[model samples]
Target: MFYMSTASGIIFLLILFRMDLGKYCDSTSRTAKAFANPLRVKDFWVLMTLPRFWAFGLFMTGVCGIYAVYDQQFPVYFSSFYPNPEDGIRAYGYLNSSQVFVEALCMLFAPWLVSRIGAKNGLILTGTIMFVRILGSGVAVDVWVIASCKMLHALEVPILLVSAFKYIAGNFDSRLSSTIYLVGFQAAQSLTAMFLAPVAGYGYDHIGFSSVYVLMAGVVGVCLLISCLTLRSESSRTPCSTVPDHAPSPPATTAVV
Candidate 1:
């Protein structure tokens, strides 16, 4: 199903590119160039050396790790609080439904919110929200309290996703947008889950969900500090085309006899 859906989206994009719609996507040629030769090791090395890349990549990694834990364990934790297993399941569904509705409403407001506080600040706000949600879930005894914390997901999703895209576009070369998203965000999330899932599973088996959550909250708190120190300030951002000026220039090519 996922493959089919992705194929369909690709086909749709192809059709758009053929039409007049693709004209708006000025960075498409740059994207084509980046992937035009995957065998180019130099390009990959250059990307790795950029401070912004690692800074944002680590932020994505940590936040994504927390998100993975919440998705897998929160339902189980939520269910445990009820008198009956079936009641817990039903209540979790209802709470999740409310969150879906709230997500829709919050998506409409995200643009305004990001505009007022810049994308970097928006990211900080979302990270702080996740910290509160994870810490609150771990310490609270009441089901209602945890449920309230879960509702923050509605606000967190829209803000985090939109701000991340804005942050990358505003701070990186426009042509590299697709490459940055794939490596910095998508790959970072996948890597975090791959390495952290087993540790979290072990923690749950030995220590329990609350302890795992508290540990995850600490990881996110550390990531927030890294983000604050590393992310480019909004006032200092230049045009995407010029953002690469801060990166160290490639060493002058040496002539090999």
Candidate 2:
């Protein structure tokens, strides 16, 4: 793990060194207005006032919390059901490998799915699937059943992630896109995981794995409900007008990277 981390860091630094900032921004004069002072608090507050942003934040938090609990507790849950620890480990390894394969396939189709259903609807679909996956995790009868649930769960990863980036790109101004995306998607999820991990551990210890999953499913269900009520359709919401017509277009592709 340490070696992998070190190699990843080295690769990232190499990529950074090779990147051309000029391609992203033509000239310092044109870029001056785009570089807003981070210390200015008003803009951040203004973005926070949007209802859609709050919905997205809540959705991210719930989904991430569900994922964290599943990732951290699944081994314990699986082990309890099996007679031997080695059998449990082997089953889990198979499940993990299946998830990786499913995720790869999902990545290939995610863009087309998002484009067909629209971002809000795509999120709703993924959220529904996630809820079902978590519920199944709690009650699945066999290792194969649990593996199937994991495969369904894996589909959400690419769909939710891609839809989120598309939603951010379509709704926010170019200047605010990165900030809103990071805060609503990444930071909110991180914060949720931080708070949820301990609570999840406690629940697992006291109530058993099934009960923990039931609780997590309830939380994710509420988030999906909130998203359904609060998130507006793309046609219904106004796009940001501040973005320059000539500004680099938002990314149209989605990949694991």
Candidate 3:
């Protein structure tokens, strides 16, 4: 851990000195203007009223909620495959480490994948894979089957991390990117886990892990159906206009970035 932190610090120092950000007027001024008046209460209310916000928020809620449940419960589920508790822990450690390694590798391809499919389709693809992976884990009788399903995390998480932010930026006001990400995505995810985690715990107590997981997957299925029906379709790398019809246009003096 100490060596890793030291190495990371050295890399950060190198980037700080080596990277040229250009003049303050060219870079910082534009960026500062881009974020100006980003979070007025009126704008936040308007944001909340948008259907796209709810649709994407629902998507985040479903995917992130199940992921939270899986994080808490998967070890217990996998442990049952081994009679010895220590053996189960060791096995789980290897499986989880492989998932992290695979996720890192997949992250490199995420940008390319999202660009080809567009953000909405990228989300749908990942959600579909998530449904199958979670369901497979629930239905599998053998440890190998479960392990294979769990490995699907490498596909789902990396794509989700990339495409979700893109979806937000494309469908909403660029100036409000921070507000949308914080209020729409992050807050929704936190709330979903807060409310759903206890329910999942209850399900585990009453119905066991497999049954609970299947039910969670069902929830994801419902969210995916909603997304498919309501989420806007767009071309690869398209820049969507964020101004709504009901809202007045920005003044002529307002700089377009």
Q: Which has the greatest TM-score?
A: 3
Rank by lDDT, descending? 1, 3, 2
- The residue-by-residue lDDT of candidate 3 on 1-257, one tens digit each, is 69998999999999999977655546336355554434456776777787777887777787766666666778888888888988988998899889989999999999999989988998899889889888888898998998888789888889988898888777777767787788767888788888888888988899988898888888889888988877777743334534433333566786789
User: Least lDDT summed over 10 consecutive residues: which range in candidate 2?
Assistant: 30-39
**lDDT tens digits, residue span 1-257, model 2:** 69998999999999999998876665544354466323246566767887777877877787665666566777767766689988888878877878888899989999999998898898888889888888898888787777777778678889988888888777766567778878988888778778888988888889978888987888888888988888767888886533334545557887786
Which ten-residue region of model 3 has the weakest summed lDDT?
236-245
Model 1 Cα lDDT, one tens digit per residue, 149-168: 88989999999888989988
Worst 10 residues of 1 by lDDT: 240-249
TM-score of predicted structure 3: 0.83
Please report how far candidate 1 places residue 32 from its true position, in Å: 11
Highest lDDT, which number?
A: 1
Name the regions of candidate 3 deviating beyond 4 angstroms: 1-39, 235-257
Off by over 4 Å in 1: 1-44, 242-257
Q: Against the hidden true structure, what lDDT does model 3 obtain?
A: 0.79
